[model samples]
Target: MKKWREYERLVSALTAEEYDKEYTVIPNARIKGFISQRKRQLDVLVEYRFNSDLNRRIIFDAKDRKRPVDIKEVEAFEGLMKDVGARRGFLICSNGYTKSALRRAQEHIVIKLLSSDQIDDISIGSWDMCRSDSCGDGLIMWDLTPGIIIDGTVYIQATGKCDSCGKFHIWCWSCGNRICIDYESELQCSCKGPWFWLTSIEPDCDEIGEQYESHYLILVLGNGNYHIMDRRPI
Candidate 1:
């Protein structure tokens, strides 16, 4: 379980540079434009921007397997690397790899295997490397300026009016979830899952614009997750 949490941080580490540079990459999701047309799910998908668009890509996959990885797995990953046409690929694992697996991975230099001990070698441009070194520190108090609420429970939220884009940003700290609003008043989770009681009628665009939207009503979704949406009316 901790490994998965760490894996998520690693995904953040892998994509943080692109994010800081204002390039977008999908996380914990499979990319669609690749060769197999959805053959695999990438933990981190880094897109390189050029000419004001994403033109090239790099990828990373974290395998938290209980047993040591095998050469067959490495071979499969190599094939995927070729199929995706990724500029570089890294396979970070919880356990070590087999000798044959290591040799097989090297046969395809694009894909390299990293044992648990080597994770510290990962280079992150912006996030303090020491922050991610601790799962609790890396996850619990993200510096995203989430609004915290306390009642029968403690929650986090980002619900309010957006000034420039002019939309509602919402969040729930207790559930550790938030909303990502785009054009119009339409909103969805970063996971892009169905909006389950995800939106409220009261906040109406006007209420958000007025900054009078009720916080308690907006923090907790029907699914019991926190929704953090930025409400800056510029």
Candidate 2:
């Protein structure tokens, strides 16, 4: 399993009825890539489309870790949403937020901090009616299975140590460039430039089929069906 799949699983376990009555969960909802003036690629752009009666959209960026989400990250997400013409945005992380980050988040956008326990609460199936886009039929479905697809790219900060070189490397799957920790180590590849086809799964859908959750970080590649490139717990 890839880290991204685990993110999906974690989100799949949330209870859908307690949240907004008209929140619909869409995993990996595509945000137009070319809209940005600088043309920056975004990771994990999930869309929460409200009921048809309410004409509004909520966007989210999920990070599966215990570290404090920095302001720069929030700024980047905000930029992406603004570029795509979205009015509201959220940053979801497995851990919590820093006091400074939380304060900063409140100043600009609607940010929600979720812990593993809260995530469990939503998964307990003890909420009200889910008003997301997919709840109209009264049939809710929770998606826990991992499904990998191609044609998606990711930008990752190098966090793991290389066994062969005994050094840290930052690899950007979107650009296919691997750099050293200090931005000094430069390794060039001749095969496919710096880009690598990464594989990851979309978040899981709640039983109500109203919301989707993020569980892990993943990379997507190719055009056909995709597969996980790294093994991690889900």
Candidate 1 segments whose C-alpha is farther than 4 A from its true place: 1-6, 14-25, 50-56, 107-179, 183-234
Residues 1-234 of candidate 1: C-alpha lDDT, one tens digit per residue: 356656555554544543533233434534343355654556655543211112244566777777877878777777766665565666766777788877777733333445556556763333321122212332221224333444445343433322112233345343555443333343445554323323333331231122112111133354577543321111
Q: lDDT for each of the candidates?
A: 0.45, 0.40
Tell me, by lDDT, which candidate is best. Answer: 1
lDDT of 2 by residue, 1-234 (tens): 355433543453242233342343443444343254343332232233211211144456667776878777777777777665455666777776676666667644665666666654444232122222323312123222223333353333222222112122334443554433321222333344333333233444333333322222223333333332221111
In model 1, the worst 10-residue window by lDDT is 207-216
Best by TM-score: 1
Clashes of 1: 23
